[model samples]
Structures are given as C-alpha cells and as structure tokens.
Target chain A: MINEKDTRLSKAFITVSFIALFLGATAGLLQTLVRGGVIELPAGIGYYQLLTAHGVLLALIFTTYFIMGFLYAGISKTLGTLYEVPLKTGWLGFWMMTFGTGLATVFILLNKATVLYTFYAPLQASPWFYIALVHVIVGSWMCAFSMWRQYYIWKQITKKKLSPLFSFMAVMTMAMWFIATLGVAAAVIFQFIPWSFGWVEKIDILISRTLFWYFGHPLVYFWLLPAYMCWYVVIPKIIGGKIFSDALARLSFVLFLLFSIPVGFHHQLLEPGISHSWKFFQVVLTFMVIIPSLMTAFSMFAVFETTGRRKGAKGLLGWLKVLPWSDVRFFAPMVGMLIFIPAGAGGIINASHQLNQVVHNTLWVTGHFHLTVASSVTLTFFGISYWLIPYLSGRTLTKKMHKLGIIQTVMWAVGMFLMSGAMHLVGLFGAPRRTAYTTYSDHPQAAEWIPYQAVMAVGGTILFLAILLVLYIAYYLAFRAPKGETEFPIGEVEAAAVQTPIILENWKLWVGISAMLILIAYTLPFWHMIEHAPPGSQGYKFW
Target chain B: MPQLETNKPKKLKKAEKEQDLKGTLLSVMLLGLFIILSWGAVYALYLSR
Candidate 1:
C-alpha cells in the first residue's frame, strides 16, 4: 500500500478529475444536440462557448489531473515515499492547478473566453482567460519539477543507475511535458496575454500558431504515455503475468520522447507561409512515431501469448481464450487497445502530407481524436480508476462495481463507434468541422451531412449516459464501497527478461537528442516565418 | 545422417516450445495490413478530389 499522506494527494487530484469529467461531458452532450439540430441552445448560451468548455475541461483539465494523480501513486509505491520538498511542491502545484481550473471555468461560463480550446490568436479572449492558462501550465511545471526531484532523491539513496520502470516512465512523461510546455508557455506569456489585454497593438498569427503546435502535438503524447505506462506495467500484473521485457518498455518510451516532439508541422500542413520542404521533413518525423507504437503493440501481444502458453494453452490462437476476459480490469483496457487499431490508422491518414487535405478542418479530425483520446486513453483511465480509486480510498472493488464498469466500457466503445465512425465517413465527404449547425441555405451537399450529424448526437447521448455511470462508480469506490484493501497492481519483470541498460537512464543523453531533433525540425522554418512575416492582425471578438 | 536429422528436429521443436511468438507475429502483421488499407483508401480519396 502507498503511504497515507501520498494517497491524500492522489485522491485530491483524482477527485478534481472526476468533477471536470462531469462538467465537460455535460457540455459535450449540449454541443452534440445543437450540432445535430435536435435542439437549439438557449438565447444566452453560444455553441462555440460550449465547445470551448468541453475541450478545455476534458482534454486539458481532466486528463492532466488524472495523469498527475496516477503518476504520484505509482511513484510513491515504486520509488518509496516522495521526499519532503517534492511532496510540498506537489501540494502547491495541485492547489494552483485547481484554482486555475476554477478561474478558467468561470470565464468560459461568462462567455469571455469562447475562443475554443486552441485559443488561436486574433480570436481573442479576456486577459484573465490567458492568465488562467498560465496558472495551469506553470502549475503542471511544478508537478513535473517535483517528480524529478523525487527521482533524483531516490537515485541518491539507492545508488542504482536504472530507476524503477514506473518511476522512470513517469519522469520521462514529465520531462517531455516540461519541454513541450515551454512553447505554449512562451506563446501565452509573451503573445496572448499582452495582445488580449491591449498592451500590444496586434498579434503575429503564424508565430503564435507555430508555437502552439510545437506544444500541441506532444500534448497528445502527454495524455497517451500514462496510458502506455498502464499497459506496460499494470495490465501484466492484473493478468497474472510479468512484464514481457523491461528494456523493451523503456526503449519504446525513449522513442516517444525523442520522436513525438519534433513533428508538429504535421498539424500545420494545410496552413500556408511554411515551406513545403520543411513540412515534408516534419511529416517524415511524424511517421517515425509509428516505430514505438508498433513496438508497443508487439510487446503487448507477446506478453499475452507468453502468459497464456505458460498456463497450458496450446495452438496458434489458443492464448487469446486464456486471458482474463471477464475481469473488468483487463476488459476495459482491452477494448481501448482494440479501438486504437482504427484510431491509429486514422492518425496515419491525418499525418500524410497530401492526404491531410482530404479531411483537414473537417469533422473527421474531431472524430479521429475522439477515438484516440476519448476512447483509447479515457477508457484506459477508467480501467485504472476501477482499482486505483478503491485502493486510494481504502475500499474494495466489489463484484457489483466491476460489472457496472464493464457495462460502462461497452457503452463508451459503442458510442465512439457510432459517432467517430460517422465523423470519419462524413469527413471524407467534405463536411466541415468546428462549425455550428448549418445547411448553407439548404444546399444539397450540406443536406447530405445531416444524417451523419444525427448519428453523432445519438452517440454523444449514449456517451453522456456512460459518463454518468463512470461518476457513480467513482463515487461508490471512493466513498460507498465496502471498506477493505485494494491492491495497487504493479507487475514484476519477467524472470527471463534481460537486464535493463543503465544508459537508458542517462537523462543528459536522451534530453540532448530530443533537443537537437526539435531544433533541426523547427529552426529554419521558424526563422522564415519571422523573417518575412505579414503585418500583425488586431484581435477579434466574433462570438 | 540419421543422427543429425533427429537432433536438428528435436532442437527446433524444443526452442519453439520454450518461446513461441508466432501468434504475436501474426497479430501485428494483421494490424499492419489494416493500417495500409485505411491509408490507401484515404489516399485514393485525395487523388479523386
């Protein structure tokens, strides 16, 4: 069991995450209804406002808080209790993040920051909105610094070159996060805040966007790495097996850290001003990410097969049947992994330089992320919650709670299939994303999209019901479940696994490589964007 | 020749039994196929458009 003080910290972060999930999901339900033309938003409420709330609250707030909490729990258990300074820093970070979230929520509700989650320049929000973002980013940095401090202290005490697998991965995630946030941090502090406050006459649109995507692409990885940690570490334990290979897991994470950062140009392929050659260069870097993803898939299958064969399973596919299918702990993430097959394929389509035009700025982009983050990442988080919440709350995961979790996962999967599937299909038909319901004055092309939008609403409604189920389960696990000890599952390395190389733990080497790659990818294009930049545009308040 | 044949087959069988990854291999290959097909379909759309 993790120490009591550490559990308190984890619980605080987890509680906030669930609260954000509830509010964000409610916003989502409304957006779907409005988009489907099933219901008009009331006179006071705007569609973009709800969309911003949905994106910021869930994509930013919920995912970050849950990840922080999960990482803290794992770090405490694996690395021994966090030291005094780091723990104090952790608390400070939590409060600041919470306060920031509250401020951001208020501004969104007041319609002062309906600029959407991207908060792209020229569509300015009130200065307080940008200030709120600063708090969130800085607060996350503090959390990152605190975890690094803990890892540093552990190395001193143990004198071990290779850190524990969980802690190492946690540090890598934070390091990537810390480096990635520098871009956004620079944009918000230097550009958005002054521009929004009228301290500056105008904002450079290309520079701000360039900076945002520098952080934006890695932000996807930030949400994802924790889910990968769960797969690489916790799932094996739940299934009564060892980690297939510790060295393999570490190598894959290092690959993500190195490759995921330098590839933001893929997001800006359709945008002008950047040269095609640079875009092609980054597109190639983006494809390099497939290496680690395939490695993960291979490792996961090998673990399952090896474990199943050891349990007396025979034949080529006999291993599949031996897995703990009925167990929610396995079942939920299993569904998530299954969803990634299509989700990842969609990502490949999105990143392909020429192919991006087919779905750029379309509902298809939105649908693709819904699968990757919402279905794959969020479902895995739910799976972790089934045990982690109970473990932190000093309660048992009852059979009833387990069954409810299974139902919730099924609902989420089906909901995403209906919604995201339609989004992908319709997007290929040239339906635009990020727009409110419109028929372009009942044009035939727009008329063709109506059925798909209705399907999205139906899916969104089912997803909302699943969200309710998640909240209920969380409440039960935290406050109402039978009081007992729930295991915090951390898998042991397989006995036959080879030794992990100490060089993998050499932070200087990895961070140096990561920095060099980012510079190579961005420096020239960024220079050109600044050298021949257009006159800055003043802020707009179209909403 | 008879002795060599018997030993080689036994060695191969033992190794396969000890650590079989054929299932994993097949699974990933199928995954690769799915990705290729999806990417191709979209690329075709891009061309037609």
Candidate 2:
C-alpha cells in the first residue's frame, strides 16, 4: 500500500487531472461540432481558441498531472515511503505545476494564446503563456528529481543492485522527460519569452521549430512510457500471468530512452530549412525506436501464451480465450494493446519520408494521434485510474462501477472508430485539419468531405457522453465506493526469466549514449541552420 | 575448451526454458504484415499523388 501522506499528494494531482479532462473534453466536443457545421460558435469564443484549450488541457495538463500522480504512487509503493525532503519536494512541484496550469489555462481561455498546442514559431502568445509553460516543465522536473532521490535512497539503504521494476521504469520515464524538456525549455526561455515580450524584435523560426520538435517527439514518449509501465509491470498481475522477462522489459525501456529523443526530425521531415540528410537520419533513428515496440509486442504475447499454457490451455490460440475479458482492469488495457497495432503502423507511415507526403498536416495525422495518444494511451490511463483511484482513496471498485467502466470503454472505442476512421479516409481525399467548417465556396471536392465531418460530429457527441460517464465514475470511486482494500496490481517476473544485467542499471552509460546520439543527429544541421539563418520575423497575432 | 564446457549446460538450460509459442509467432507475423501493407498502401498513394 502507498503511504497515507503520499496518497494525499497523488489524490490531489489526480483530482486536478480529472478536472482538466472534463474541461478538455468539453472543448473537444465544441471543436468537432464547429468543424462539422453542426454548430457555429459565437464571436467571443473562436474555434482555434477551443482547439488550443483542448490540446493544452488534455494533452499537456491531464497527461502530465496523471503521470506524476501515478508515478508517485508506484514509487512510494515499490521504493517505500518518500522521505521528508522528497515528500516536501513533491508538494512543492505539485503547487507549482498547478499554478502554472492555472495561469496558462486562463490565457488560453481569453484567446490570447490561440497558437494551439505546438505553439509553433512566428505566431506568438502573451509572454505569460510561455512563462506558464516554463513553470509546468520546471515543476515536473522537481517531481522527477524527487522520484530519483527516493530511488537513490532505496538503493543506498538496501544496497540492492537492481531497483524494483516499477521504480526503474519511473526513473527512466522521468530521466527521459528531463533530457527531452531541455529542448523546449531552451526554445521557450530564450526565443519565445523574449520575442513575445518585445525584448527581442524577431525570432529565428527554424531554430524555434527545430527546438520545439526536439522536445515534441519525445514528449509523446513521455506520455506513453507510463502507460507502457502499466502494460509491462501491472497488466500481467491482472491477467494471472508473470512478466515474460525482467531483462527484456528493462532492455526495451533502455532502448526507448536512447532512441526516442534523437529522432525528432521525423516530425520535421517535410519542413524545409533542415537538410534532407538530417531528416533521413532522424527517420532511421525513429525506425530504431520501433524495435522496442516490437519487442514489447512479442513479450506481451509470450506472457499470455506462457500463462495460459501453464493453466492447461491447449491449441495455438487457446490462450487468448483464457484472458479475463470480463475484468475492466484487464479489458481496458487489452483493447489499448489491440489499438496500438494500427497506431504503431500509422506511426511508421508518418515517419516514412515519402509516405509522410500523403498525410502531413492533414486530418490523417490528427486521426493517427487520436488513435495513439487519445485511444491507446488515454484508455490505458483510464485503466490505471480504475484501480489506482480506489486504491489511493482506500475504496473498492464495486461491480456496478466495473460495468459502467466497461460501457465507457466501449463507448470510447466506438466513438474513436467513427471519428478517427472518418478522419483518415477524408484526409486521404485531401480534407485539411484544424480548419473551421467550410465548403471552400462549395467546391466539388470540398463537398465530398461533408459526410465524414458529420460522422465525426456523431462520434464526438458519443465521446463527450463517455467523458461524462468517466467523470461520474471517478467521482463515485473517490467518494462513494465502499470502504475496502483494492490491490495495487503489480506483476511478478517468471522464475525462469533471465536475470536483469547490472548494465541496465547504469544511468551514466545510457544517458551519455542518448546525449551523444542527439548531438550527432543534430549538431551539424543546427550549425547549418544558424550559419545560413534568414532574418528573423516579428511575431504575428493572426488570431 | 574450458569455456565451452562451462557454457554448454547454460545454453541447453536456456533453450529448455524458451518455449516455442506458435500463437505468439503467428500474431507478431500478422502484425508485421499489417504494418508492411499499410506502409505500402500509403506509398502507393504517395506515388500516385
């Protein structure tokens, strides 16, 4: 069990996260409706404004807060209670992040920062928005340091060579976050803040974009690794299986840390100013990151097969039938794992330089991430919430709540299928994303996209309903569920699993390699961009 | 010669523990095929465009 004091901190973070979910989902609902021509917004609230809120609140605030809370709980549970210093640090981080979120959110709501989540250069928001981002990143850094300190203390006390699997994964996630955020931190502090504040008259658009994406690409992994932690560490226990291999899991995570950061140029493959060679290089590294995902897939299937066979199941696929489909804890992440097949496929296509031409800046790209982060990652987060909330709150997930959770998951899957499916199809037909409802003066091709938009509207409405259900369930679990113990399900490794090599625990080696890769991948291209730098442009407030 | 003797039983033990999961093999193969097919489809589109 997690300590009572630590639970308070986790509960606070989760509470704020759910609040963001409600607000963000509401913004998402409005966006779909507006884009579908089902409704027109009043002049006071613009589509871009709602879009900004949707991205920031859900993609940034909800994920970060939820991840921090979940990591804290797992760390406290596995590494023992947080010491006074780290505990206080956790609280300090929580307040700062909350304050930053509040400040950034207020600016977005006022439409002063309608630059969308990427907040791409040449478009500027209030200086406060950038400062708010700084707070959020630094605040997360505080939590990351605290978790590391806790792990270090555990190692010192126990003198154990290997950290607990969950804590190890947490440190990996936070370490990657610290390294990845440096790019965005540099961009925001040096370029964005000063430019927006008029301390600088102009900004180097290419450098700013290069830096943002340096953070942006790995930012997705930061969101994804926690979900992976659940898949690798927690799901097997829920399914009555042992981890297929501790060494394999740690090795895959190590690979992710090394490969995920240096591949940022895959996002910039189409953007000019960066040479084709560098983009191609990053694309190759992006493919290298796929190795770990493939490893994860193999490991997952092996775990299921081994467990089912041990249960006396027979036949090639008999193991699938033995899985606990009725349990929401398993069902939610099970569906997520299934969705990731296509999501991972789509990611490969997106990073492919030539194939990216077919979908870049299109609704297909939007549809792709919706499948990945929204469906796969978000569903896994919800699965974690089902147990983590009740466990932290000292309550039980009653049968009724379980039923509701399943219904919510189904609703989400169906909604996503309609919305994201239509997006992918229509985007192939050249429908642009991030635009308000328009027939382009009734052009014939533009008219073809109408049906898909309508379908997306229907999907969005269902998704909004699902969001409401999730919120209600969160409330019920936190306050009304019967007082009882809920197992914080963490799986054990199989006895026959190979011993995790001590090299996997070597942080300096991994981080150093990661940094070296980033430098090699970026150094010359960055120097070129600076040397041949075009004159900077003053910020625009097109909104 | 000494190293080979020491590693011999270890290799056998490793092989013994490694189960040939036919279903997992087929599943991942199918996953790989899907990725290839999707990439090919998009590539064809890129070519056409």
Candidate 3:
C-alpha cells in the first residue's frame, strides 16, 4: 500500500489531469462539428481559440500531469519507504502547474491568444500566454527534480545494484522531458515573451520556429515513454508473462535519451531558412531513433510467445490466442501497440524528406498525429487510468466497470480508424487542416474531400461518446466503488543466460552522450540563424 | 514422496522453450518486413500523385 502522503500527491495530480481531459475533449468535439459543417461555431469564440485550448489542455496539461502522477506512484511503490521524496516540493509543483494552467486558459477563452499551440511568432499571443506556459514548464521541472533526487538518494544508498526497472524508466522519462523543454524555454524566454511585451519591436520567425521544432519532436517522445514504461513494466505481468529481458528494456530507454532530442529538424524539412545538410544530418538521426521502438516490438512479442508456450499452446501465431485479451488492463495497452504499428510506419513516412512533400501542411499530418497522440498515447493513458484510479482511491474496479473499459477501448479503436482513415484519404485529396470552412462547395477541385469530411464527423461523434464512457468509468472507480487496495504489477524477467551490462546503468555517461549529440545537431544551425539573421516582422492579430 | 519420471517432462519443456524462442525471432522478422512493405506502398502512392 502507498503511504498516505504519496497517495494524496498522486490523487491531486490525477484529479487535475482529468479536469483538463474533460475540457480539452469538449473543445475537440466543437472543432470537429464546426469543421464538418454539421454545426456553426458560436459567435465570439473563433475556431483557432478552440484549437489552441484543445492542444494546450490535452497535450500540455493532461499528459504532463498524468505522467507526473504516474511516475510518483511508480517511484513510491518500487522504492518503498527506503527513499523519501520531499512531499512539500511535489505539492509546490502541483500548485504552480495548476495556477499556470488557469492563467493560460483565461487567455485562450478570451481569444486573446489564438496563435495555435505551435505559437509561431509574427502571429503573436498576449504576453500573459507565454508567461503562463513558462510557469507550466518550470513547475514540471521541479517535479522532475524531486523524482531525480529520490533516485540519487537511492543510488547512494545501494552503490552497485541497478535501480528497479520502473524507477529507472521513470527517471529516464523525466530526464528526457527536462532536456526536451530547453528549446521551448529558450524560445519563450528570449524571443516570444519579449516581443509579446512590446519590449522588442519584432521577432525572427525562422529562429523561433527552429527552436519550437527542436522541442516539438522530442515532446512526442515525452508523451510516448510513459506509455512505454507501462508496456515494459506492467503489461507483461498483467498478461501472465515475465519480461523477456531486463537488459534490453534499460538499453531501449538509454537509446531514447541519446537519440530522441537531436532529431527535431525532420519537422523543419520544408522550411527554407535551415540548410539541406543540417536537415539531412537530422534525418539520419531520426531513422536511428526507430531502433528502440523496433527493440520494444521484438521484446513484447517474445514475452507473449514464451508465456503462451508455457501455457501449453502450440504452432506459430497460436500464442496470440492463448494470451489474455479480456482483462482491460492488458487489452487496452496491447491494442495500443497494434495501432502504433501503423502509426509508427506513418511517422517514418512523415520523417522521410522526399515523401513529406506530399503530406506537409495537409490533413495527412493531422491524421498521422491523431493516430499517434490521439489513438496510441491517449488510449494507453485510458488503460493506465483503469488500474491507477482504483489503486489511488482504494477502490475495487467492479466486473461491470471492466466490461465498460473493454467497450471503451474497442469503440475507440473503431472510431479512430474511421476518423483518422478518412482524414488520411481526404488529406491526400488536398483538404487543409485547421481551416474552419473549406470552400469545397464552390470549388470543383476541392469537392472530392467533402464525403470524407462527413465520414470524419461521424467517426468523431462516436469518439466523443467513447470519451464520455471513459469519464464515467473513471468517476465510478474513483468515487462509487468499494474501497480496496490494488497491486502494482511490476513484471519479473525470465531467467536468461546473460546478465545486464553495467554500462547501461551508467547515468553519467548516458547523459553526457545525450548532451553532446544535442550540441552537435543544434550548434551550427542556431549559429547560422543568428549570424545571418533575416529582417524581423512585427506581431499581427488577424482574428 | 517419490520423484516419478520428472526428467522427461523437464527435457520436453526445455525443448519447447527453445522452439518458442525461434518462433519469436521469426515473428519479429515478419513484422519488420511488413512495416517496410507498408512504407513502400505509401511512398509509391505518393510518387504516383
């Protein structure tokens, strides 16, 4: 059982996360309805306002708070009373993040900051928006520091022993996030904030964009690694299998730390200010980052096969049938992995310089990210919530609720398939994303995208219903269920011939390499942008 | 308590484990192949456009 203090901390973070999820999802439904031409947007609330709110609340608030809460619970459970993470510091971080979210939400609601989540300057937001975002980042950094401190103390106490896999994964996730936020931090602090305050007359759009993408790509990993943590540490145990290899799991996280941050240039491939050589260099790094994901796929399948064989299943692919598919905890994350197979493949297409030309700035990009962040990451979080809410609230997840969970995931998969699939098809036919209304009715050339948009609207309605089901389940688990403690399922590794290498656990060495890589990838590009700086443009508000 | 014919079953289990490992490796290879083919198809479509 978790101590009272730790439980309270986790609960606070998770509660706020759910609040963010509800608000963000509401905005999502409104945007979809308006875009589909099914309903007109209410006056005084622009489409960009809804868009900004959806991105901030879901991408920034929901994911960050949920991750913070999950890591805290994971660390507490794995380390036990042996390590004391300062509860006071954690509470401080929570308040800061909450206050910051409130500040940002005000601006979004007022339509004072309709600069989308990318917030590319020349299209400026209120100064308060940038300041509010900095608070969110700084708040997250404090929480990360607290977790890192606990790890440090544990390491000091147990000199040579490798940290528990869950704790290790949690630390790696936070460390990657802390590093990834540096680019955004620089952009906000140096350029955007100053210009927004009228302290600077104009801002360099290219430089700001370059900085944002630097954070943008790794930001996806920041969302992904926690889901991966659950996949690596929890899913195997739920499925009645042991981890395939402990060493491989650690190696994968290490690989992510080394490769995830420096490859953001792939997002800027079409931009003119950044040169081809630097972009090519980042493209190579981008492909290299795919190795860890491939490693995860192999390890997961191996675990399934071994476990299925142990249960007396025979023949190739027969293992698939023997594994547990009914348990919501197991079913949700496994389905997430299945969706990611296609999503990851789509990501490869997005990263490829030649192929990206066909899909850039189109609904295809929207479709790709929806498959990733919306389907894969969001579904995994939904899965985590099934157990986590019950565990935190000391409640039993009843049988009825388990059935609800199953319906939620399956319906979500079907809905997302329809919506994202239609999006990809229509995108290829030249439908633009982020547009409130397409003049497809007037223009014959754009008419091909209309039917697909209708399909997307229908799919989105189904998805919105699925979200409601999830919220109901979460509410039932948290407030209505019978009180009981749930176990943290940390999978044990099956016996292997080889031992985990000591080098994989060397945090200092790995951090050094990650820093060196970022420096190599970013230094020259930033220098070029600064030295040969283009004429800056004044901020404008079209809305 | 008598230890009655445990060795034979132990040997069989080990053999099965080995077979499963090989199968797992094969499955990984197949998945990689599938991803590559999917990418190729998508890129080809893009080229046609």
Inter-residue clash pairs, candidate 3: A394-A484
lDDT of 1 at A112: 98
- Model 1, range A1-543, lDDT digits (tens) per residue? 789999999999999999999999999999999999899999999999999999999999999999999999999999998789999999999988988899999999999999999999899999999999999999999899999999999999999898989999999999999999999999999999998888998999999999999999999999999999999999999999889999999999999999999999999999999999999999999999989999999999988998899898899899999999878999999899989999999999999997899999999999999999999999999999999999999999999988999999999998989999889888989999999999999999999999999999999999999999999999999999999999989999987678999889899999999999999999999999999999999999999
Candidate with more favorable, higher DockQ: 1 or 2: 1
Angstrom error of the Cα, residue A433, model 3: value is 1.6
Better candidate by TM-score, 2 or 3: 2
Candidate 1: TM-score? 0.98
Order by TM-score, highest first:
1, 2, 3
- DockQ of every candidate structure: 0.77, 0.67, 0.57
Q: Candidate 3 - CAPRI tier?
A: medium
Q: CAPRI verdict on model 1?
A: medium
C-alpha lDDT values of all predictions: 0.94, 0.93, 0.87
C-alpha TM-score for every candidate: 0.98, 0.97, 0.96
Number of the top-ranking candidate, with DockQ as the measure: 1
**Model 1 error, position A353 (Å):** 0.4
DockQ agreement of candidate 1 with the native complex: 0.77
**Model 2 regions more than 4 Å off:** B1-20
lDDT of 3 at A366: 87
> TM-score of model 2, chain A?
0.99
Candidate 2, residues A1-543, lDDT tens digits: the string is: 778999999999999999999999999999999888899998799999999999999999999999999999999989999999899999999999999999999999888999999999899999999999999999999999899999999999999999999999999999999999999999999999999999999999999999998999999999899999999999999989999899999999999999999998889888889989889989999999999999999999998888888887789899999988888998888888899999999999999976788898889988989999999999999999999999999999999988999999999999999999999999888899888899999999999999999999999999999999999999999999999999999899998787999999999999999999999999999999999999999999999
lDDT at A442 for candidate 2?
A: 99
